[model samples]
Target chain A: MTTAGINIHTGKAMPLNQANVDTDQIIPKQFLTAVTKSGYGKHLFHDWRYLDQHEQVPNPDFVFNKTEHQGASVLLTRENFGCGSSREHAPWSLDDYGFKVVIGTSFADIFYGNCINNQLLPVQLTSSQMDQLFALVESDASAQITVNLQDQTVKVKDLNFGFEIAEQHKTNLLKGLDAIGQTLELDDKITAFENNLPQWQKA
Target chain B: MATTLYDKIWQAHIIDAKKTSETGEEGLIYIDRHLIHEVTTPQAFAGLDEKGRKVRCPERTFATMDHSISTRSLALDACGPTNKLQLQTLADNCKKHGIELFPVGHQKQGIVHVMGPELGLIQPGMTVVCGDSHTATHGAFGALAFGIGTSQVEHVFATQTLKQSKAKSMQVQVNGSLPIGITAKDIILAIIGKIGHAGATGYVIEYSGEAISALSMEERMTVCNMSIEAGAKAGLIAPDQTTFDYLEGREYAPKGDNWTQAVAYWNSLKSDKDATFDTVIQLNAADITPQVTWGTNPGQVIGVNQPVPSPNDFSDPIDKDSANKALKYMDLAPGQKLSELSVNNVFIGSCTNGRIEDMRAAAAIAKHGKVAPGVTAIVVPGSVSVKAQAEAEQLDKIFIEAGFEWRLPGCSMCLGMNDDILTQGDRCASTSNRNFEGRQGRGSRTHLVSPAMAAAAALAGHFADVRDYQ
Candidate 1:
């Protein structure tokens, strides 16, 4: 299956039922030496998948090891997702692992901001709404949830759940802007602010 | 209504409230001091070089190599591969930009946050920025201090000012006296438990009340240092006689006749009796006991005598799932007594709890007992002066006799930036913040508790309460 962005219009159903999944667990500390986020996918669950016997995949009971959930790009998690260490690598690894959208009840403040900046759609939903979505994904292995950035809604079967996106954040994500890019978007305003500063303070 | 200390300091630093043409609707505040460390400075300096910029306020910017520097190695040659490279890079950057560098073996070389206050570099009514999260430690001196990112680091280097939003003020007042065995660590852990990690977001917390006032300056610093762990912008204590005494005769502190003037100014830094805050939280000091973290996050803590709760105990499914997942990773049984759990390592160090008082507390406990045979215990002081004082007081001998490694001063095992780390699946009784899985090392299990509790655990070979040992 080709893993890419999941659009609300294209329609599919995928969900990851987990909670309080910290950044340290997402990508182990051993891989932190790598300066960039380019190759963190294979080592996503280093301890969960690997064994003492030469790094082979082990722990068949682990959640990510389940066969049916393989290659599902949309991750549906419980509340307070990404609730540890401020490592930006967590979302980087998740994005690299083909997850374009993470719908959860809530997220850590830093991680949520990070995911948004990195173009990963972190959807915050109500618990009852998330419970309904979780039930739909559990019922069908091939079921895929559709998340439309344009509509700012997540649909699991006929049940439609509305998700909020700040108008500025929505525009930035749609255009794929980081903090610098976002700042640059208001270039004229920034210039005006600089020009307005008193000449004595301009040094 | 009377304004809190946060309001007083914040209003003084605001350069502009109007929406800036370049930085948007951000308030540009003048930065009085800037601290830099090895891990976050290289990229920031590189950015400055790319812009052909000299540090705009070299006098305000000070660099130190601590995050990657090993506590074991005092000499440059003994520094490991990564640290050696980091130190060299730091030296190069500081020299190139004419910024002051606290190199290895220097008296001032310690955790950037610790050294800042000791030298009187961080003072009252000042805006301090550092590339370290624990920069808020300086807030103990009544300064408005907080951390910023590498890009912000460069911005401060070029402009000597930071663009920031004003934070709301919070007063966390703990009244009455603490229990016999409990310390400031217990107070902070209890606070983190009472208010969830994100509860203090966007607020500068001012710790007050008779209990806070009773604490020594070092004890106050410990509490303020961990304020960031609760996601607070900063934590502070009103300046008192102890604060003035500690600052007196310091290298950068006001000298001669200026000392009197400085003290008069420092006295004014305290909150007025009728000062109001955005939020006020009260806790009875006598009610708190020795606290320990049972789950991955700092907020998932309980009193040392309490049992770990089962996932089903929580009404919220989100809380339940987090508790369940934490139990799985920590290999802890639901409803199991925390005091009965065995520990393999005991670490008594970090910017959080590595002060002299913490070392003295651990030594007092370790002096009476020996570390369990299988337990690997280490006592790391916060700075060179702290280590010297420990040795002077024979505290190092006490730890060594008790089978704990009396290591040098630096941040060690406090996130495993250096060689001190727990091996895979090894559980540690840590006196640091954040018990997140693998935080001490890859696949390492961490149980966060107070220093005295860590010492008790080290002696007992399990997570036992310090009151039992006392």
Candidate 2:
């Protein structure tokens, strides 16, 4: 599997501070009508980010609407981010919105899978670690936080936090490899197994 | 070692399995049936086109247009431009890839989950996958069926395999017979209430015991269909004579010598007596009544006779917080009687409850009287075949005569994908799965119920207990 390698990322972290943030909140169903994946950034968090139906006015109360978080690329949130609905568009919207990393206490299974497949990294940190990162980011919005996938560490000035991820996923991301590409490499084995199947079982 | 039904099926479909380098987890299980829908497959087909790859096994794959099409009419051109484009893209993609597609106006067209088993394409011991989460509905046949992302969809299209980590096993046993009015939807809702929304996370549940075995094939599908709502990866029941009977003569089912051989294999798909699960839970069917969701999540449910629960009733902070938010979104007060809540709309369809049996249950109630003057009720058959069956029995006439719209087969109000939707602040008694805020429409309040309960609510213009109608 080959992927756009991401050994290190340094960016401002935006704090969402919500739990069980579902995919609908990430990207509303109405915005999912687009045929391609590229144009979803503008509609990310449609209901929360916008105050009116036309989406011409931004909701100032929203985290993303604040001036300080304009160019933020890392999202920090509480547990169970991206729950409900297995739409891969959630990650597509996030990735299109320029978020390279989403750090949360936990994530829904399918959303985590989708993020991994889409080249957006979802980092699971302990609750205390999440609190530390949030506190650090909040204390100084200008503080640049760095995530090093090579060392499995998240560093914010004096504080450094360690995280764990599956080796295969880590390798896939680092190599810019698509999952289907990796699976295709095992074609010889797959074809061999298909050949050995009974006549009735062959598709 | 005694094997579970999940393990047996998982083992049977293994083309290549190995522990991943990071977590040492099993990976790469082959899929037997890959079902596709327009809503989630467009991106996947685009991925295939980008790679210039063909569908690995066209015979094992099936495509349909459901989520983005209008269920109000059979005319394919009647859908809005966005939905029309999605349907056209799906049809074109299927034509390009040699995949079998049941497009709008086709007799086989319906929700992907519903059409799979209805066509007898989902058999016991097969590994089934689809881009939509409700694909778990096929697990009722004892298959390892689960929803997948578009990336996985493309992977399955490319290799007919998925890299998966083994899920923990959970066994839920409903040991007693249910009362007359309580249907499979009620039982599943009751279970979800007991086990909160995240109770079955990372687990594949196997529902067993007398109650499960007693349910008809359609009822079992209803149970498995909502497994994802409870956060389960998949849900399964051991294949039995009822399962075989349901599949025996269907369109894609085996025939003659193959039928006999298939049944013999399905018989061996059940779990061994000594097989152990990670968790075991038991519920008495007698303790359950007709259920309805009082909050935004399916897990926030209560019996029809019960009052709405206050956030104060929950000790956990997370539960209390979520309950408060749900109540605010749903515009409900504590201590309110669920049966007294008025509904402006009643939808008795979706992949969950759009089967022929579900239509029959609703027809029985609508036949008794007309829909209440202020209510807008719609009954959508799961598939064109189911619609044909309902028309043959004149069930559509019963519904139409009662002022309920008899519509074409598609996933309508279930997710607000089409024209069938509730206006803002409108409360609906819906038979579809998921009561999430805005699931049906913006600011729409959904109370999940069975078809009979939805019909009863339609007639009464409020949440009416089906038992009273019975």
Candidate 3:
């Protein structure tokens, strides 16, 4: 079984309310040169958060620079998160940057799959549910919620909401199985099919 | 259940069901219409040579030079070092193997995805395979088209088939009326946003519904072109009057009585009214807006008025962290509106959004306004005919007067295969797919958007909504 990282138990949810969070914004194109996924975290928003070339720096008004949510782990966004190009690096950067769970009204199809496959939990909440979570985050910056993969429930205070996950995908994520590993789980069936092919062709 | 387009096309191309060599697995399905290009063909061809095998059916295979040829109108001889060898090699390989090759300067030379349908090689009721993901563009013609790797390319060359598993079918029906300014680009972007980019993976998307049916053949093609971006095998709208009209009297299309027979069969290449799909997604056409990519991938996008998402707004640490990172690279405030963002250059071309219609759309905007100062802008058509048509209508002159460079077509700045590229620290609003860092060139920043949006951005010298101008 895959061991859980830092649990993003949050009853408080701040809604980004924006649509279409593209991959380039998640991990800027500048950081894609490295062969490995290492060291990309530092540069993830280098230009966005700070101005290195200019004498003036740190636009304190930026959401990432705000004090209330500094070091906040869980992220909640509006509809259509991760919509743009299909660079696998987008998810890789997200996984490496200490995000354990992402709750949104919806996500771009490829990014959602990549996030799920890479062991990052991307929860699709109803728009109303997202609004509620946003309200919680706005009221209490330190609000805590529980996302229990075992129960497939997202807990916020007295409310526990069910989230659907494909059975196979759930199993693979819990077990830290990549596509190859998951494909290997059906090895026996594959072998059986192979064995039957040539003989069946003759028939 | 009634037969779907998927059922009809898949049935027509099934050559054999044979067991695998390694495990004698259940017989895998074979395919026809194998397509190759410079990006993935060299190694496969080399592998074949090493194995001492001749191309099994060179006639069935076709090659083209788009990924590595200069789109500059200055002639093919002037192509830079990077593409010269690859371009030459494509011609040499096609000559040696007796496969049809569309080298630079040939009327057929264009994006492999564009040329396939234009040449009628990708027809109804056939299985088409290419080494590029965008090959799914061919599926618009009722063909089963998808991308494959080099090894798979070699397999098709050797045996004209591939080992494959069937995919579940998904139908995305978009009904209702599209707004006047809305184009196929907007429809696709809106779909990706609605369904998420990977929503269609492991499935072929059959686009139906009222809006799709009303679209022109070219419009349908624009929608199918990006099916791969959504992680689908392909996308298609059922062939109809538009298809018949476009194919009539074309070079490769069937003629006279043969055309009648073909149309009769083509009419049958649709999902039956009562047919079912594994999943059905219904969308309203009026809800979509012109889309733009703010991040590296096609899925990371926003409407013209939306603000960039900030990480603090997320409950998941990864999403927060990733958003923070994206905000950094894009050099924008997460909470800031997209309209306020500035653009350095505007590029209107590529397999995704480059076409005669695309050029015309950009020209429509350019005709009314001059490109904003300091905004470097260009409009590269998809083919020679497209360029000629643009010139015939004086679209090129209109673009030129508006300070947009009009150039020959060859995947310019789409994937940086040739000399067309963005310099370090240059930010461009592009009409191409993919904004992977340096995808256009080293240290280049690309924001993907619709052609109309690109034109608007050029006029504003920044990211702005076309609706404002409209």
| lDDT of model 1 at position B111 | 77
TM-score of 2: 0.96
What would the per-residue lDDT of candidate 1 be over residues B191-281, giving only the tens digit for each residue? 9888876667667899998889898878888888878777787888878788888888888777777777777777888777898888899
DockQ of candidate 2 relative to the true structure:
0.64
Using lDDT, rank the candidates from best to worst: 2, 1, 3
TM-score of chain A of 3: 0.79
Using lDDT as the yardstick, the better of models 2 and 3 is: 2
| Over 4 Å off, model 2 | A135-139, A157-159, B20-24
Best candidate, lDDT: 2
Q: What C-alpha lDDT does candidate 1 achieve relative to the native structure?
A: 0.76
lDDT digits (tens) for residues A33-141 of candidate 2:
6677777888888877887757899999999998888899899998778877889999998988889999998887788888888888889898888888888878888
Error of 2 at B80 (Å): 2.0
Local accuracy by lDDT, each model: 0.76, 0.88, 0.69
Worst lDDT run of 10 residues, candidate 3 chain B, spans B19-28
**lDDT (tens digit, per residue) of candidate 2 on B79-104:** 67887788788889999999999988
Regarding DockQ, does 1 or 2 come out ahead?
Answer: 2
Q: Residue-wise lDDT of candidate 3 within A1-203, one digit each (tens)?
A: 12343233443343355545655556654343332434555554444555552315775755666778766666787766775544445655655655568888777555665575557788887877777777777777777777877678888776677887655446656666434333334446544543453321211
Q: Which ten residues in a row have the lowest lDDT in candidate 1 chain B?
A: B17-26
